[model samples]
Target: MTVTEELVRKRAEHNEGEICSLEELALHQQDIEKIEFLNKNCKKLRILYLQNNLISRIENINRLKELEYLNLALNNIEIIENLEGCESLKKLELTVNFIGDLTSVENLVNLGTLEELYLIGNPCTDYTGYREYVIATLPQLKVLDGEEIGKSERITAFQNLSKHYKTILKSQEDYFYKRVCRFLSVNVQALEKVQAQQRRETFSKKLEENNGDIEKIAKEFWQEKGPYTPESRTETYEFLRLQKEQESQKAASFEETKPRRKIFFAEDGRPYNINEPKIEFKFYEEIMENEQYFVLDIAAYKNMDTSLIDCDVQTNYVRVTLRNKVFQMALPEEVHPDKSSVQRSRVTGRLLVRMPKVKSSSIIEPQNTKWKRTTGSVEKTESKDKMKGGKSNFLTVGETTASVDWRNITNAEDSRSGDLEMQKRAPVHRRKERENSPSFVDNPDVPPLE
Candidate 1:
């Protein structure tokens, strides 16, 4: 698991802009073996967490000048070196590591801003006069291994340092030789294979416990660890990163194997309809003076090239091509292909298609209209006087003209009886005038009531 640029980027946050803008990063428990790509990609990092990994050497991080905190706990790091460039570093955590070189505390003598150091559970912590040596060497350290160094303690450490200096060096050299001998005697390849097997077994057990569901196991594990913690965040990021890679690979394979489709007519000579671009659109029909038109509006991107769009209007349907995608829609009414037109709006980038409907002519015959006038008056002489003038009301149909003679008009018996029955069924509610209330009298001298 060599730390690559991709892994570093995936484990980082606030990196949407240039990589140099990254300030804080977490790469814990990722099995990363070496620190890489950060010195070039994230030179402005302020805080970094690289604990619980397989990293053995601290290198390639001298460019992080703004770093304030560095966590390298639970790693295979043996010696502390190459940290002279972190000018603003205030806290360093190297707990639970294999660091046995007590003389490595000399690396902090140049770090003036370093205030706290943690070397708990490390081989170097058990060295004789370890606390005194560290306190005397790094004078700016306010706390060491969860304990605060007082003025009196710092003075006593300085006083005892000269007496224990040669003894500490001798012990450090012996431990170094033993560490080298152990490193040479162990089978590195077999150890790595065992570690890998153990990890797989752990994963398999978790999967079985969750009924062989990877997602369920992952959810349970992260939930048990709680949220907003380093472990949970790291695990979640790794899971998502692997998922994205798998999805990308599957997509690439699918694209390579997918069959191309025909957009227009099929092999059977039947027209084909397809909407490969999957553009959202609206369609409607309008009528103006017996002329029907079909309007189709396609929503397209504003920056899309206008040359990519093509349209073909047919009698029963309209076909549109958008960036090699065929979009065909059926129209209820047939349209004239020659008169159809298409336009695109510059402001909204919408494809507007105007198709004129096919015109149809209907054959009709003119018929004669009969006119009859019914009057309540029964006097023939009065009707005759009314028709004496040539200005009679007449209706003309095509080339024939006709007029009605009121003197010869007659009403039907059923119509007259029906009218009389309707009048009888009417409920007329009225009050008769008060007869005895007052009597009207005309006065010549009195004016009307003011």
Candidate 2:
């Protein structure tokens, strides 16, 4: 993949929406095949690390004049060049690369500030007189391949540079032939097929969502990528950039179009209740012993963080916010917000709110139910007809009788026996004159004479 402006800005540690303010940047192991955008944007960078990549050329970094350290180890770089603009460079690391050109070491002569140079594990390191040629050519280098160049070694390398010159030249020729054969043996078509496979795997999820429509996916992939040319890589990166921007714009549009809920007050100057989250809840008054409370239980989202939930309990209403969505309702009775307590169940994730009632109330009966009266007496009418052939037992009209017989008004079969039983249980000195009369056989209150 080629380095893009977005990638550079993201890798800038001190970047606060601007890349020029950055001093250090590390872009290692990102599979970057080409170097781009750093020279044009981050001109103030001091230290740069672009190691462990697929980069084959060193380019587009000549503008980093403030750069002091550069690390380009373990890449496909064959020759180190295009760093004449880094006047303040002190150390350079190019370890374990394919640098076969020993003559390219002379390029660092322009960077007079370079002190340490590392080229260990490179193709040029195995050449005859490689260390001597590097030390003699770059006089400013204090350390080479992790070893400090002593005064004696530097003097000896400069003296013998003439003798090893012909052998170094022969080795360079051999390496050139080897590099050509290596490139010739590689199958370009096979490498391209592998790259295409990787691209397919990258978009495999999109393919599955499209029901495995290869033709549609191919058309979409090559939408802006024009005919096969050297700039096809640049075209692919541009397409990705546009796709990301479009996604961001779509998200912003969705947020702008979402419906917003109004709480607190209605448009007509009345209190309003909103349940934007549509949470199911139960609000009721509970009477327990001497205490009464207004209980509200809401079925909030399960396993949600408590930090995302907010609650406010008022005298006659309640408001709960879940992840910014408001859920509010008016209470059936006034409550005390200060004395209210709220708890969340760990098992069911239910929010339970209990508010002390402002005015305690008892259980009220239904308005439509009727009740029997407990006060006042009931009067009854007395019969006027007299018993046949018997003296009047009931009192006559306007006559003030001293006593009246209650057995005459009772049922005939139960009067005598029932009254006798009651008279036996009654207090002593009660009247027995009626019992002494001679109408015992005819009296209906009397039991059978047999």
Candidate 3:
């Protein structure tokens, strides 16, 4: 073991009651359980720095009840779990880590003492934006990464995000907004609007009961739901409910219809797989950078059906209308016709389709017309075939042309020649080549008289 490895098992002791230690445990590679020992041994561990190590678990430190400041930065931690009940974590440094989610960390809202957060190297490089996200989440993160909010560099970031939020709250911005919204996650705006409408209803009802003026009531309504607080909405309110509702309802309807999109089957009674390039299309509902429930891209199931298709399909060039919004999308189209696919999942676009089951159809015996007899077969052709003098096959018009043969052309040289052949054969409208065109063969390879 090295000196640093020995330091991990180090214990600071004294004859006094207790001693607080800001442990700087660094560069201990492949040591996942290093903090596990400290959690059990170090009773006075205040600020722990187990960064740049292989510390994969946070639950180890969760046992450190006195652990006020923890720096678990630069680790391979995927989930931010088990840090919920640790109400003493005033400062958290999660930089340079693979942590992508905040599942259980949201409940750390009660830790009102959280002041500074260093989430630099992790996915959250934009501390300003992530601060707001964590603000909305933890609601207690004030000083994020040694920077003060509502002042300094953070104010501009907040102002920009505030505008984005404003655009979402403003009138129906664009077609995409009616499809999916953004910054609010999936359909948060719709949920908030429902809540806001309820609050407005309650406020309006209270105002009526209190016999307040209509203008004051409107102002109060704004105050309750305005950008600022309930007390400041009087002068800063715009009654855009009707318009916002229309957009919100469109989004809600799309969302309501989205989860109902059944996957895993094709129309011909076959299980759908994601590998089917043609049949696979994305079912996307995005909240844009400045819009609510906006449809970024949409595709019809008819255009995405690949059951009848055989080969690889290249739909990289596709222009279609989705929920009245025109968008250029990339997906697969019919390329290879011989390849049969049972699962449809490869195509990524704006929607995925689960084709309806091919229900069995009852055989309809000759109801309209009886079949006519063939020459040597006991087959009955349709009566219409008698008028036409021949019976037709069930195959399509071009089924016989499936395989392509390279031979059997009139001229082999024409087939092998370059595209220059077509350019040469093109009509030039020239009367005579000798009179109009310059002859290279008539002149020698030597330079002409300058």
Candidate 4:
């Protein structure tokens, strides 16, 4: 039944003062949208059951400051918000919801008395190390998603959380890399071969920095490849250098056979080289607080003069030049070039480019896009079908006439191309410090004190 003052009074009368006030209410499966009627009526309410409803948000509950046990299971709630006033709540049921981020759980951690939290069947449960993350975040949580949090489990979760987080990041990186490769029409095998050579070169440089000390390098390699002798180390280094040289030669041969396209010049009159080294940076495009941003790091080129840095922003392309290094890529989304700003950090050498989004109602027309020029630029032509429909004329650069989706081309310049497994195996410098600290699982023979 719909929760009303009349219904609450009727129940109180029928129970012979047992339900003296609307202190406890069971309004399940009522399809109720608003509970404004219970604002002043349920002044002494401590328990509330509103499960199996169509409630999409947790609002209008600020008046329930005295509420302790709140059963909100089986609702359509997407975010864990609007519970700032529930300081007295101890047990909160939020199962079968759409909570996807762990930060939502962090928000609930502010409720110091929240001992029992049910969050099963939520989208966040599918996250890697979900249980461990929740356990680590809310140490006071005794029962989590119907499972009791043991002392040993808590210690293990805290110990392995960083490792699990790294795994999650690697998975995201792999997804982005695959998307980029598909957008660039680049063969995955060819990219992998190039990356392998780059890794070998990096290793060789590190070895040379150590003054070719085979004994010292052997100690570092022992953990990964078992014991290594000086002869084995020298042989391995030679093999890597040889393999890298061979890969470079093969790439050069392929480029020679391939028809080279003409170089495109930036709006600033600087010709962009197709064979130039790709910029060493990481970037992500995101929309925040009604504004779009293209954040990127250019710390690798810190030695370059800041005054020499030039940026040319267009609807479909963004060309950033720093001395000899140039970063030119097609933008993924249409943005207002007039509302963009570039800022460089002197300490970390990172660059932040803010691009405000255009109004949604504005119509964005596709611009004539060109890549590395081939033979020559041909005249714009229209077919019979294009003329009848009044479509844009196609521009021919080389022998092919096509309309390119420049947004997809932005993924080709990603610098983080390392394998996920290789990145996971990277040494953690803080691991030793964590191990030296006391833990509940330090002694297997003794039971946990908690």
Give the alpha-carbon lDDT of every model. Answer: 0.76, 0.79, 0.47, 0.66
Give me the runs in candidate 4 sitting further than 4 Å from their true place.
Answer: 1-20, 163-450
The better candidate by TM-score, 1 or 4, is 1
Winner of 1 and 2 under lDDT: 2
Candidate 4 Cα deviation (angstroms), residue 188: 31
The CA lDDT at 363 in model 4 is: 29
* Tens digits of per-residue lDDT for model 1, 192-307: 45764675578778756764446655565455533232233345556655556656766787898987675466676456556778889988765545666778888976788988
Clashes of each: 0, 0, 40, 2
Please provide, for model 2 over 100-215, each residue's C-alpha lDDT reduced to its tens digit, 9 standing for 90 to 100.
Answer: 88898888899999999999988789988999889999999999999999999999999999877888889999988865554455675566567767765766777568654445
Q: What is the TM-score of each candidate against the true structure?
A: 0.47, 0.48, 0.30, 0.35
TM-score of 1: 0.47
Consecutive 10-residue window with the lowest summed lDDT within model 3: 228-237
For residues 112-211, could you state the per-residue lDDT of candidate 3 as single tens digits? 7777777665543422345555545554567766666554444445456554344433322342243245324647667656766787687668656854
Give me the candidate number with maximum lDDT: 2
Ordered from best to worst TM-score, the candidate numbers read 2, 1, 4, 3
Clashing pairs in 2: none
Q: What TM-score would candidate 4 get against the native?
A: 0.35
Best by TM-score: 2
